[model samples]
Target: MRKYIGELGLIITAFIWGSGFVVTSISLDYYSAYQNMAVRFLIGGVILGLVFYKKMKHVQKGTVIKGAILGSILYLAFALQTVGLQFTTPSKNAFLTAVNVVIVPLIGWAIYKKRMDKFEVAGAVLAMLGIGFLSLKFSAELNIGDILSFLCAIVFAFHIIYTAKFVKTENPIHLTVVQLLAAAVMGFIILLFRGEAAVPIVDGAVFSLVYLGIFGTAAAFLLQTVAQKFISETKAAIILSTESFWGMVLSIAVLGEVITLKMAVGAALILLAILISETKPRFLKAMPLREKV
Candidate 1:
């Protein structure tokens, strides 16, 4: 039951992030990418801090260190993806970022000396292939954006790995608040350095930013941090990869985007990947038969 709850939390997180795609499009119309990052993180951090002030007061030094590491990695991953998007097609950028689904298990195996689970590995691979089908255009061209996006994927994989490790010893809510605040600081620093620190006051921008800050950044990440406590990092990545599927569904519903055959195939593959990872099927199990006298 706990495990299922964790999985459900991750699914909700993915859905929130998927919904972010549409809000992001709207937000970008009024705010720059850097500004969006800074504002959203700030809003999320403030909200979390206010809501969990008592917990925040008891945060440990080790938790702060772990949270800072996660915060830095999170900022770097988003920075890479945002910059990569400037040079690459959105589809390509998204597909490459989703590569984190595969990298999570590899990081565990290579760095932590953990044994690879065959079902998890297979599911990760299938999820990556599904993302490719969902977002790739088969451009057959390599560029700086592609490289950066790949690097973003690697960083995101680390974020998941470290979040799982850190949550074991630290309070998840405290960790979440600290990491969000740290990320907000980093975003602000970058904005100041770039001389783009001005905040947007437009009503639509405000609404979009607030929605992202609350649901997408704060709630989604808090849920993810809590959920990782109950599931393997690889399985978490497999489930979160469904963000792309949710994005497609929301796009179809909200933006009236036409669904394609490729989208259907990709969504199916992602579902199958989740099923495979969640239920390592055994085909050779014997069935008992009863005879009536």
Candidate 2:
């Protein structure tokens, strides 16, 4: 049940993050990518950091170092993804980002000597196919942004696995807070060098920034850190990959967008992948079925 609780946390993280696309779009309209995120994570870090100050104060140096390492990897993931988005179509960016689901198991196999189980390999294959259909264009031309997005997937896979590893010894709250601070610090340095460090205040920007900081960055990452304690990296990635499906649902339900048949099929495949990963579905059962009368 504790494991289930952890999986539940990851699912909620995916939902909050899926919903974040909207506010993120709004926030981006007001500032440059790194500039906006610098503010987002800084604000989030401050809020959660203050609340967890007592815990953070007592944390060992090793824990802070672990969080900083996680945060650095996270910054690379976000930075690459953001820059990639600027250069490519959103669909392509998203599909490429979702490739992390497949990358995680491979990383696990290579780094931990944990071979990919049949179900995980099958699920990753299914998820990749689903993502391709859901988000990729047949004529999707290769470009620098696509390369960056793919690299982002690799880094994100590392982030997921490392977070799982680090959370074993450290408190998730302090880890989450420090990770936020790490990203915030990187964002600050990058924007500082570029001279885009100042952020302007406005109602729309403020609302989006607040949402991204509180729920999107703070709560979502915290949930992921805590959730990883109960789930394997591969299982966690498979579950988180469903965020694309949820994103599509939000598009249709909240944005009044029409669902294309292609999207429906793609969504079905992704759901099928999730079912395959989490349960003993008939799809993965062996051999000939009993004949029906």
Scored by lDDT, the top model is 1
Candidate whose TM-score is highest: 1
Query: lDDT by residue for model 1 over 188-238, one digit each (tens)?
Result: 999999999888599767899999999999999999999999999999999
Instruction: Please give each candidate's TM-score.
Output: 0.95, 0.94
Residue 175 lDDT in model 1?
91
Expressed as tens digits, the lDDT of each residue in 1-293 for candidate 2 is 98899889988998898888888888888878888889888988999988887877787898889999998999999999999998998889999999999999888887777766667667777887787888887664899899999999999999999999999988889899999999999989999899997778887689999999999999999999999998888888988887888788898999998999888888888888777877856656663422222
C-alpha-based local distance difference test score of model 1? 0.92
> What clash pairs does model 1 have?
none
Note each model's CA RMSD in angstroms: 5.9, 4.7
Segments of candidate 1 deviating more than 4 angstroms: 283-293
* Runs off by more than 4 Å, candidate 2: 282-293
